[model samples]
Target: MEILNEQVPAPADVGNALIGIRGGSELDLDLRLEAVHEGILVSGTATAQIAGECGRCLDSIEYDYEADIQELFYYEESEEFEDDDDVDQYWVIGDLIDIDPVLRSAVVTALPFQPVCREDCLGLCNECGINLNEDPEHHHEILDPRWAALAQLSDNVAEDAATNKTSDKREEK
Candidate 1:
């Protein structure tokens, strides 16, 4: 916002654009003013650090984001003014154009739809509700229900054999 002042010397109205972005957890921008044929074209970069949940691991995600912005301030009577296009327009008063809206828009445009913390992150298990990151042992087990039924049948057979042995011993005594 400090850099948007007209008091800042502007480049000659030509093909030049000025650009700068201030760093913060949330960013502030210095309007990049490029001298254009019709008006001063402001273009530059700003950044906002996005910190929140990771989509995959559900861990805290921190991202450094950079965005580019462009804003044009045309004089009311400037030749670029069109009657129909002028119906909905933004204007600058006292030789000053505010670029805050432009800055906000640029940052939003550069953001990812869903930010991930890491590329190869192993997410939490849906069934056991365990954090895969924390556990390196027994990562996963695959079970077949048919095999499980066979295992149960073997256990019952062993139990029956042991019971029959005890009954025979009692009868002999």
Candidate 2:
């Protein structure tokens, strides 16, 4: 049994499109390695600095995320995982275990698919590309295309009514 605590640089492409850990950033790893009957068991946590854009408002978002890491590396001669072809199996290579893939899997899976800067973010206006969070009341007076014909009809009716009223007043005078 052994404890491994180290700070290493984060790898590239450690998350989804919306959010990810920047390459070369600080990564803190705190884990315990144990030798079991089948293989070596690694369980720990990896903390990384996350950076990305908000999916809602396209704003810059930055935060820290800690991902849990746990996996078993089987010895070269071990045949325990041979029956399960669907599951991925890790191996101990030359008395060393490569935890990069394990750490990456842990961090990437925990990242949000759609990252947002805030829960109440109003997002951007589709019509004008303006951030609604800055001005929540901001809007454009855009009438629906389906109702445009009805609006035009109402304007024409008002014009006709005014014209008739003016003619009637002239006749009375």
Highest lDDT among the candidates is held by which one?
2
Off by over 4 Å in 1: 1-26, 35-37, 73-98, 136-173
Shift in Å, residue 60, candidate 2: 1.3
Residue 140 accuracy (lDDT) in model 1:
59
Candidate 2's residue-wise lDDT over 1-173, tens digit each? 99999999899988888899999999999999999877899998989999999998999999988888889999888877666887878999879999988988888878889999999988999998899999899989999999999999999999999999999999999
Q: Candidate 1 on 46-156: residue-level lDDT in tens? A: 555555565666787665565566667676567775558535344556687766556545554555455566777777776686877777463557667879989889999
Question: Candidates' lDDT values, in order?
Answer: 0.58, 0.91
TM-score of each: 0.55, 0.92
Backbone clash count for every predicted candidate, in the order shown: 4, 0
User: Any runs in candidate 2 off by more than 4 Å, and if so which?
Assistant: none
Q: After superposition, how far is residue 112 of candidate 2 from its true place, in Å?
A: 0.9
Reference-based TM-score, model 1: 0.55
